[model samples]
Target chain A: AQTVTQSQPEMSVQEAETVTLSCTYDTSESDYYLFWYKQPPSRQMILVIRQEAYKQQNATENRFSVNFQKAAKSFSLKISDSQLGDAAMYFCAYTNQAGTALIFGKGTTLSVSS
Target chain B: DVKVTQSSRYLVKRTGEKVFLECVQDMDHENMFWYRQDPGLGLRLIYFSYDVKMKEKGDIPEGYSVSREKKERFSLILESASTNQTSMYLCASRYAGTGTYEQYFGPGTRLTVT
Candidate 1:
């Protein structure tokens, strides 16, 4: 069984600043995928970024990036030039090569202050 | 663009009532999943299907059942809805592949049971 953990329950970032949300997971599978998802007030889940466990390089998507440390079992999400629209609940998820379901973290509430 | 649509955005039901949540995906995805989101519990997978008519139980499948008679449709059912089952339900789907693949999600259905 794989378990994702997001230690921070809530986080706040000033507008135009940068913020990092931490995530860690426990999985015995060598081949896997890591993902970050955002859910806004509309209750729609949106994919933020993704990282392949085999790739040593981190994944970046515009203002959203991931710091994936496979050895440490850590995958953190970083948001740069944060705006008010970035205020949402962020979740970290994991999926293995066995075609199994995704395991998700508790989530971190990001409050972007103006 | 891939679209996963839920039948309802909000629903209210009483305890012991049978509840059904429908989800349809237009991307011809091979995998469909149902999850429940709670305040601090993140998203817990209740059921998933890899192909039509094939269902698998996930982490929290105690009170939930699922049906996938068609490739594009997946349904989640609660035999006897309870107050504790009142939460946001999400539906997601992904293409079948060995490597990393992103899952597309639908706007969640918020179910309130009294």
Candidate 2:
């Protein structure tokens, strides 16, 4: 069974700074995808970024990027120039090659300090 | 832009009451999902349907059932509500196409079973 783990239960970042949320997953499949989703107080889940397992280059979307280490099974999210709006619960997710469904990790609540 | 909408943003139901959560996507997505989100648990998939009238059980399908009578609508039903089931319910949809790994989500419904 594939399982994702987010180690930090809570993370704090300053506005205009940077923060990284750690996530690791256990899976045997060689071809898969990793994703980071942000849920704000409005309770809307928004896709932040995604990384393909076969791609050596990490995926970047605006201020959000991922450090995808397929060998270590680590897929961490990095938020650069964090804004107050970045404060939200971030979740890491995994999907197999079939892309049927996502396996999410225990989320990390990110707090952006001004 | 893909738009996924839930029937309610907040719901209060009594114990043992039957609960129905409806989700509709305007993008005509082929895959729809129901997930339960709790603090520290991220999101756990309950059920998913790849097509109309086709459903599949996810990681945690107990005490939950689903219906997909149309391609864009997916409904999650709780046979009997319980306090433990009081959590945020999220609906998601994805295009069942190769290389389309992202899932669009709706504003969640926070169901409080008292």
Candidate 1 chain B weakest ten by summed lDDT:
B94-103
Candidate 2 scores a C-alpha RMSD against the true structure in Å of 1.0
What TM-score does each of the candidates earn? 0.97, 0.97
Question: What tens-digit string does per-residue lDDT give for candidate 2 at B1-114?
Answer: 999999999999999999999999999889999998888778989999999999999989999999999898999999999999999999999999998479999999999999
True contacts kept of each: 0.92, 0.83
DockQ of each: 0.85, 0.84
Compose the digit string of candidate 2's lDDT tens values, residues A1-114: 999999999999889999999999999999999999998987689988989898999999999888888999999999999999999999999999899999999999999999
Local lDDT at A102 for model 2: 96
DockQ for model 2 equals: 0.84
Off by over 4 Å in 1: none
The superposed Cα distance between candidate 2 and the true structure at residue A91, in angstroms, equals 0.5
